[model samples]
Target: MTPTERPAGIVVVLAFAGITASLMQTLVVPLLGDLPRLLDTSASNATWVVTATLLAGSVATTVIGRLGDLYGKRRMLLVCSVPLVAGSVVCALAGSLVTMIVGRALQGIGMGIVPLGISALRDLLPPERLGSAIALISSSLGIGGALGLPLAAVVAENSSWRALFWGAAVLSAVVALLVWLLVPPTSPGAVGKFDFVGAGILGVGLICLLLAVSKGADWGWTSGTTLGLGAAAVVVLPAWGCWELRTRYPLVDMRVTARPQVLVTNIASIALGLSMYAQALILPQLLQLPGSTGHGLDQSMLEMGLWMAPAGIVMMLLSPVGARLSDARGPKVTLVVGSLVLALGYGSSVVLLGSPWTVMLVSAVCAMGVGLAYGAMPALIMAGVPETDTAAANSFNTLMRSIGTSVSAAMVGVVLSQMTVERGGVLVPSEGAFRTGMLIGCGLALVAAAVAAAIPVRSARRTSDHGVAAAERSAASVS
Candidate 1:
């Protein structure tokens, strides 16, 4: 569509919601240093500020995505902004780390905006603009993250870290108002009994799983508490899967997920999550470690934030390109290329992480891979499920990435724990452990690529059974 004719206002509102939701997490990265001292907690514990947000976001995304489908997409979008606002307020006033963690958890509710936004696009936007809009909103995950880090750093340097959350809170409220004003209201998308049982099982399972990941290294993964939780997870998760298969309105359709393509893509998404987390979690440590640590880059928070800033733009730039490619050749091809590029990125990091420029370059490469794989995911999901199932299916895809990142955090933590300093007293990554993690990530991305390739792409465009009826009405009206 021509620029003058485009529905820029509506799309921008969606984008705003997407950006604010994701920004909540990244904006906190630069604040990790001050949080421990400010809250009188250990640095390790302060990390929960990030972990809590991620965990809450992961669960909320699934639940809200389904509700958005069952209720109205636009209605859910409006409701999502409520938590974003509330979370920001809590974080702004949080005196201790515990309160901040709670606040962050609340902020996670905003993660719903993107997937639900995709659902909304199917209803609100014309077809010609749909693909590009999807690409942009999806890539907002990366873009918001990238932008949030630098913007937070700048704000924290000049003022207080608390102000950052306040700012986010304000931004979320503004977005909420804009959405209410600009986006059209519509009827609900699906009618079914909400899967209370499935939600409970999955929520408990993930909380256990994430708690294990986030705290295992601190608590000793082999401790009774850890082992007991692990054992319960093994039992509970399978039981949940069985329960889902039997239920009519399952929280997750484990049956459909049993498909090779879906299963493999999820597996790949997890790996990519792990690989992506390494950079997000690890590199910042590497960059800011004191010069006393032989290999430390010794960069200030702002400098490091600036250095990492360009990666977000690269991701934004590649998203549509990947989507276009997916449309022409297939999403599978785009996903495959993304995974390989991601592997190449980690490999590049092994060689070039020491230099600022090199680190940025490798980051851009990884961003490109993320753009490809992430961009392709929705298409894969929408193609596989009936129209009524769109929100739930996409929610699962989103969940996989969350699980993947959490798992990666655990794996990376283990690797870093086993690490030793070089002869020069620089923190030297265990070459074996580091390479092992990267190679695993690369392998996972490869698996995702293969899975994407194997998924039988429909020869023709997907014709939605229910939503299509509305589209037909609109078309006839225009004629």
Candidate 2:
């Protein structure tokens, strides 16, 4: 395992770990309808099962990624796995809503795996392979979600719901073992005290913002609680930014992030996040709603999951293509192309929404764009930041995407909630609402392309060759 030797096993192990962590996000989808009954809780309380994971993941990804940069990516990756395993076991045995939420929160903490894995690849892989490796790893976020739904749906349909958690626990344990065995130990990062205060301030702000977004519909969009949280986030996040800039060894380096390349990439990332999630929110509903509603396909949860699973495979398969594009034309160009593809996918949805198969095609096309865009983000971010700051920088980028998704949830939620048609005494999202959501997604994707196009290209002299050597040397030592 010299610097010259390629450790393909590390790529596989890290990608598997990332996919396992992401699967947790969608693992509970099939159980959503049954959750209240199983936990003997009210529907409103049951939603906490999902919300807890969202909040915990949003907070943990940034914190854990920074910790990985400060400590060791391999070390923190292993640490994240413990929570996933333990959380799965807790969920397996849980008989109450409170316990389920607790389990989900624990599972959310493992969401750091994707960012940490991407960062680790920079340290562990050869430069030639780095792009594809990052692409595959980043795309795992969507890959796992797409695959998990159908698998979880089938499992939940035919077996005990506890089996999902049990399966997850087993998979997590395997990931932990594989990482411990295959991932090379790296040198500790920047020699400075952890920024506890900075982490805390950022955490609180994110929690408030995400909570407001995720729960706003349930809580009443104009309610005092939502407005209060929104206002607090507006204030606290800026305060956190100021604190990060002033603090030594900050959790995230604002100076580096503020660079035009990094800043615009992140801005585009938010738009891509919004675009990616709009389909997730819209397609399943369209598939599951009663066909008598005209626009609805009336598929079962399992059927809908099956329809969506191929998109995950398509995303994984497209990762290498994205990597090639990044290597050929730069990640900036790759990102712009990806954004256009995403817009095309949503546009196709306008006409393809009629059948399950056509909708699947639309999803696959969108996923291809996600595969391309998700991969380029890390490439773009890494190119701008130094080696020591890689994990934290990437983590912040991951956080930006999460923020985008949260906003998408709120936006689409408003539309679907407002434009509804009555079907058999129940209100369902009208065809018009679904179409509007798709159009919004299309427009946002185009916006993302514009932002990406605006990012300035770097000169060869400004790019750091030392960073690349350091990463190779680090990988060589452990190998």
Candidate 3:
């Protein structure tokens, strides 16, 4: 590929890869109720099907990103796809809960593709085109989550559940082929010794932290197991941080990460993730709960998914607009706009709870905010870090969002569990409880807006200079 050649094929391929990776997050949501029966396992065991993926994805994303920085983004991308393809096939043939958990863990490894794809945009796309390309790719995270639910619900309702896995397998294979053909090879990565020690330390800490967050409700938050893991993380993570600072070629460069611009953007990312996921958690249930409950929409799973699917489309449509905004007003301004929109969406939910259409409208508004925020986040991080640290920094930012979502799930679970109404001998979250969750989401979004407002304007100029330098290096390598 020449410097003058456009990267249309590259952007599409990378975006498709991102969508493929994110689809794994929601692929099994439709199967949750049926999982115990399908695998002949207890409900607690079935939950691991979800938890395992979360843990694996959290760890794999960080680890694979550092590896991509050391090896090559395109190479690691292909490496990541192998697991996705194999995991989907294994899942298609899975006969037990254990097999399903293993396969899901493998699928989680593929989540690295999203950040790798974003970092690759920094490498291959021109400075002028980079903003929109990055926005579209980043927005795919929300797009896949939004679309996957309805798509999965339809497949599960109409066919053997196994067909879902088979379809994912085919898609993963296709993505691998497309990436190989469309994505051009870049220069060799930073030559440094692989930090196995740092990787192990970080992996253990994240696994412990995430497991406790995702399962603390089921396991009893203060139980010995949860407490022990929590305690271990508190100790392990700080130690991991100390080590990163001391090491010569750390997996993540703590100095760059600690910069005011980078640190503040990451902090805002967590809040944004919490705000975005809270709506996702609450709306579907409100739409699907028994209408007899008076507060519920009395819709089926497929109906709920269909209602929610439009939000994904709205994110995709709004992403390019966000890119233009970033170009005109700077990413920090775009991020603030996104955060305020997100808060407005949540505030609207307080009134929109009466009907399905209103709920969808609120969801679409939130998606629009999410599309803008997600697009700007990577641009901010890329601006603050050197080109060599691009993948690692983006991956860390991605991890912060996952952490926020995990915390949201735990906090929302606590609220819904505490404030429940009896319905047909089963307890469900009350209308007030859902409203409270939305309020919390609104508050988080406002916090994000405040944090984004604080990022220095000087960071944008710094990033532009770095981008030009990086592009020059890329062109020289290609020649």
Candidate 4:
């Protein structure tokens, strides 16, 4: 059947693909404590399971998005599924740390599916149906993450940890088959020589920067390795930018990316990403900590995840509402409102840490903001860029969010590690530290709101209308 004939099938298939890819983000969370024992490795070495995925995903998201714009997005979508399935299988059979990290890195390479799926919506769906479909796919990242934790916790507690990877393998294989059978092929969005040099340079720079951000706390923030990687990122990223600007066929169109609308939206995205993650880090710790700390809820991992799972459901349910808000008031206003809601969620955490119910309430509110913001970001980005650049622009925006989350993890780690209370001779994070983390999230959310509010409203509307008209023309020609 033609893409237009089955748009709903395409959306559901792609959204499922996105959710399957994002599940990698939290799949290993439940096993983090047992990884060293399971793999017979040191604690630090075991961490590479998580860090490898982050580094791989960060690099692969942009590169794959660019590839999708050059080749058929459907082709790239299938290609992405290969590694996701393979990685899950590898991880399932992994008996050592090296094998597990290798599998995780492969899984991360598939992270581009979310952006690719979002871009595909623009290609396949009518403009009227675009907003809500994009909203659902974009928010799938949070949906998968919030839901994966509880499911993983349950499996890890009852069965072999390998069962988690085996399940992932099956889910990924199903997503791949669905995409192949259900999602129609789209025309390549751009024609250009693939920028191998830019991809490599950007990969190197990102690896350096993310490695430092994610590992700094464990590696000693002042250590030579951390400092050196940080220095390399500082130098390498600028060089990569210069190369991109000079290249005839750039991996990322720096000129388009420098537009006021796109730039401001990206800036706001970073802050929103940071704010979104800060709560994810702090609240689970608060929930799992012993109640003796005066602020802890003393919940099991499964219980904590169950409490948080509602937030994911809330995000899923709110997608269409956010779409209506964007349709009525513009994506800029939606973004601003979402950021404010996020700030409100964090701010309320200051006074609501007394019980799991209050904590769940805070999480649901924050998820609502994230749902609105995530839904609007792509609309804002796609509005600013030509249709040809949709996937690349969205991928870059996704990268910005990744950077924000990395920074948040590092910053929150420092705060929680330093301000610890002695609980049975163990240095657990104190109540004050959790509060401070929430305040930090709150402040960043406000910053996001302010930045989003500054997006050039008139220019964005003009560009968006022009983009839509051009896309319609292109589709007519294709048909």
Candidate 5:
């Protein structure tokens, strides 16, 4: 089967499902205090509501993405929503932390949907509208995260936390209905066997890697468990890469990925992810710290979420504009602008930590920069590869972003641990530790810029559709 233009209803359905799925992670945060009592768990245990979703999301995305490439994206889209619905229902009725964690994991199936939906845009929208359409899909990740907190806060304050999950369930159901009615059926990519062996290794490897990253600080970074998991990941990922090269139909094509453009994009994606999350991890700490520190806002989660909401809105609103610019001017320009803005934003964060409003203003500017880079990346990947691998490639890109965020989170953890302020005085971080991470983000952004600038715009310009003759030749050279 081939794709035809989808009905407008279908497009809305896909986008809505994608967005609600994203809400699953952040929405749980507002209920942070309530969770411990409701679920009979410790405050620390309650954090798993967010972590479970993230862990499932990080692994399920790439695997499902590959499956989409091998099977059909539309089919996977329908199947994926089952978790969103089931997970929400489970959480709504859960009486224990263990059960809720399971539910959260199920809800994570939604994370993979965004990448799939973005790739699906090419199938639904006309060429003229494609840029903006992709922009909305890509930016949904941040938008859902931003919107989830405040919305959940309002719901939790007015009623119950269960309502949040229930709402997500209801929203997901609507998306499922829309997708069934809207998205056109299509064949899977690359005619061959599924890469079960490769998927197994990569999936397990990533889970161990993320478990280690998310819990490293709590578990003791040097603990036998953490060190063992780290070693396993080190051994497993490279082995998986090698196996992908040898396999006929790999879950991921290391060979294609090794291409200069793809490899460079992945590098930038990690940097972008880290830079994007800096405020996410840092600002909350700054805002919630004791006000006596002079730099702290001593805000509650609701206040912090509200303050940060504008940055997310900026990312959402600017994504389309950035996408159009990527199409017209090129992705390189968008990426460069995004990173520069990000560095500038952090610079503001360092200087104006006392004035929370200035941080919000600067963060929004950084988000605009992120919108540009995030929007341009998928377009760049799509332009370089055949349509067959679009969803999988997009998922892989999302994976890299997750990795970057995890890396940043873990590294930032180490930094915060080392830089505790004295019992009483102006709050001061280990200036060197914090700046090291920020500088790394800035450097990677510049590298992404360099990669984008080299896209051979004048010479490598392509028609909307081209013969698949070239990608097959490159792909066939796998061994």
Candidate 6:
């Protein structure tokens, strides 16, 4: 059926694809402690299983998003599924750390599905139906991450850990089938020779920057390896900017991205990403820490995940509400409100960390803000960019969030590692560390609100009107 005839089906399939791709982010979390034993590798080597996925996903999201715009979003969506399925199968069969890391990296390449699917919504859905669909798909990253933890924990507790990857393989295969059947093909949005040089340079720069941020704590913040990667990123990224501006066809259009509306929205996105991830890092440990620490709730991984799963549900339920707020008051207002709510959530955590129930309340409140902010971000991005650049632009915005979360992980790690209490001769994060992390999140969320408030209202309205007109025209053509 044509997209116009089955827009709901298209949205459902694409959102499912997005959720499946995001599931990879937390699929192995339940096995993190067991990884060293499972792969018969050192603890440090086992960490590569997680780091490889983060690095691979960060690079692939932008590249694949551009590819989707250059080719067909539907075609690229299908292409993305292939690696997800293959990676899951490989991970299921992996008996070594290298093999598992390779599989995880391959799965990370599929992370483009979310943004690609979001860009596709602009092409396939009526403008009226667009906001809610985009919101749902955009929030699927958190939704999957939230829900995957409990699901993975359960499987890890009851069955062989390989079953987790095996299940992922089946789910990915299903997503591929559903997309092939339900998603309508879209014409290439932009025409140009792919910028191989720009992609390579940006990839190197991102790897350097993200590697430094993600591994800095483990490598020692001032260690030569960390400092060298940080220095390389500092040098390489600006060079990449110069190359992008000078190249005939750039991987990312620097000129367009520098617009005040897009620029500010991306800045807010980074802060929101950092704020959103801080809670994710802090709360689980807070819940799972032993009761002897005075602040620990003493929950098992499964129990902790179940308590946190409500946050995912809150994000899902709030997607349409956020869309309506955007429809009524504008996406900017929605973004601002979301940021404030995020800050409030974190602020409450200062007093709420004493119990699992209270901690869940904090996570749910933050998830509400994340749902609102995440939905509005792409709307602001798509409004600022031309229809032809939607996929690449959205991908870049997603990359900004990834960067924020990476930094968040590093910063929180530093705090938790340093502010520790001795428990049974082992150092565990002190209560002060958890409170400090939440306060940092609270500060970043306020910063996000300020940045979102700074987005030019006039430019946003003008570009949004143009984007809506373009979408209506595209829908009309399809009909």
RMSD of each: 4.4, 3.3, 2.8, 2.5, 3.5, 2.7
State the RMSD for candidate 3: 2.8
TM-score of each candidate? Answer: 0.90, 0.96, 0.96, 0.97, 0.90, 0.97
Q: For model 1, how does the per-residue alpha-carbon lDDT over 54-170 read when each residue is reduced to its tens digit?
A: 788887888888887788888999999998999999999999988999889889878888888877776677655665666677778888988888898999999977889889989
How does candidate 5 score on lDDT?
0.74
Model 3 agreement with the true structure over 310-330: per-residue lDDT tens digits:
999999999899888887777
Clash count in backbone of candidate 1:
1
Residue-wise C-alpha lDDT for candidate 5, range 300-369, written one tens digit per residue? 7778778888877898889767766666556656666777777677666555555668767866776777
Cα error, residue 410 of model 5, in Å, equals 1.1
Off by over 4 Å in 4: 458-479
Better-scoring candidate (lDDT), 5 or 6: 6
- Model with the higher TM-score, candidate 5 or 6: 6
For all candidates in order, the CA lDDT equals 0.75, 0.89, 0.89, 0.90, 0.74, 0.90
Between candidates 1 and 6, the one scoring higher on lDDT is 6
State how far residue 412 of model 1 sits from its true place (Å): 1.2
Tell me the tens digit of each residue's lDDT in model 6 across 251-289.
Answer: 888987897778999999999988889999999999999
Kindly list the per-residue Cα lDDT of model 2 for residues 1-479, writing each as its tens digit: 44226468889999999999999999999998889899999888888998899899989998887898889999999999999999999999999998999999999999999999999987787776787888899999999999999999999999999999999999999999999888988666766888999989998999999989999999998999999999999999999999999998899989978977789999999999998899999999999999999889999999999999999999999999988887767788889999999999999987899999999999999998888999888878887777778889899999999999989988999999999999999999999999999999999999999999998755322211233334334433432
- Location of the lowest summed lDDT over 10 successive residues in candidate 5: 463-472
How badly does each model clash, as a count of residue pairs? 1, 0, 0, 0, 1, 0
Clashing pairs in 1: 294-426
